[model samples]
Target: MKKTLLISHNREKLLNALVYFSKSTRFCGKTKLFKLLYFLDFIHFRETGRSITGLNYYAWDKGPVPQDLFHELKQPDTDLKETIALLEQSEDEDYRLCRVIAKKPFDPKYFSRREKKIMEELSFVFKDALAKDMVEITHLSGTPWDKTMKEKGPGKRIDYSLAVDGSKGSLSLEEIKERMSEIKEVTEIFGDQ
Candidate 1:
């Protein structure tokens, strides 16, 4: 039997669709379904204060915000400062998507098991580079980091330090992701060493 989380609004329609979708041979895992439901819940919560309850008894109040819900609620906005404050105070884990993905509302756990395994392999490769002093990692956590980044866009801000080598003067991972092609173009204009 497929697990389901039923929200308050559009119950009959959503349930009917979910039932049909669940029977498909192409159906993905419960995690994927949870993600969709979670996002819907977040939109519901933002538009109205009520969170999705009664989904096979897996409730946000009882545990971490559903991964999809966490991702949806973390998007950047004009009220990002206030939203971040609300998120920090809530049950969601403080996932620094800006650092990892250069976007808000990233959920690593949303990836398929195979995809996550590939990411783990890539992570080890990157970690090795850092260990050999070829790359550096930096981490930003807590309110101070959030405040700084809020004032300065991710492109121009450095929030947390994971690894740094002053000799290289390279961009942080966040910056690299944010300005991938731009960095190359700018460097070409300035002439590479």
Candidate 2:
């Protein structure tokens, strides 16, 4: 028997990822923050069949946006209230860019080794790139966002399944076994209804 895997979303991980990017540059803008997070989650999922942030990425007008995270950022008293305060909004033409404010270093306990590695690597890659460049890169054809945008236009949900589409062999043996065990436990408990 097979069962859907249980997924847990961690706000701490989200904050760590955001802080990692914000720390790498002077002030990571809104678009860059979204794109960085998208990469962090999607790439991690591709390699491990699980996202670090556990966010659902949607094909929005700009690019792949995490709907839940976006909603939380809009709220003022959420767990992310401190993190939200660090974002300084600026109007760039018709777009609003959320620039990051300097804050104390984020605790590292929230991130796994793999998640941390991906975040660092992505931050380095996009260190000097502009937000518009990130948008173009994320919108490349064959990406989940591209496919979703093509089929349903903007504002559609970019299926999470796309992250693992070509990542069957990306996981190490240990990771593969761990995933299998998790699935087995779920199926055993549910027992096919």
Top lDDT hit: 2
Candidate 1 residue pairs in clash (backbone atoms < 3 Å) = 5-55, 137-162, 137-163, 138-161, 138-162, 139-160, 139-161, 139-162, 140-160
Q: After superposing candidate 2, which stretches have Cα over 4 Å from the reference?
A: 1-9, 84-96, 165-193
Model 1: per-residue lDDT, tens digit, 75-106? 53332222222211222374211211111333
TM-score of 2: 0.77
Instruction: List, residue by residue over 69-130, the lDDT tens digit for candidate 2.
Output: 77666664334555545555756777666786535477787788878888889878988887
Which candidate has the top score in TM-score? 2
Query: Candidate 1 has what TM-score?
Result: 0.22
RMSD of candidates 1 onward, in order: 18.7, 6.4
Clashes per candidate (backbone, < 3 Å): 9, 0
Query: How does model 2 fare in lDDT?
Result: 0.73
Model 1 spans with C-alpha error above 4 angstroms: 1-14, 20-27, 52-193
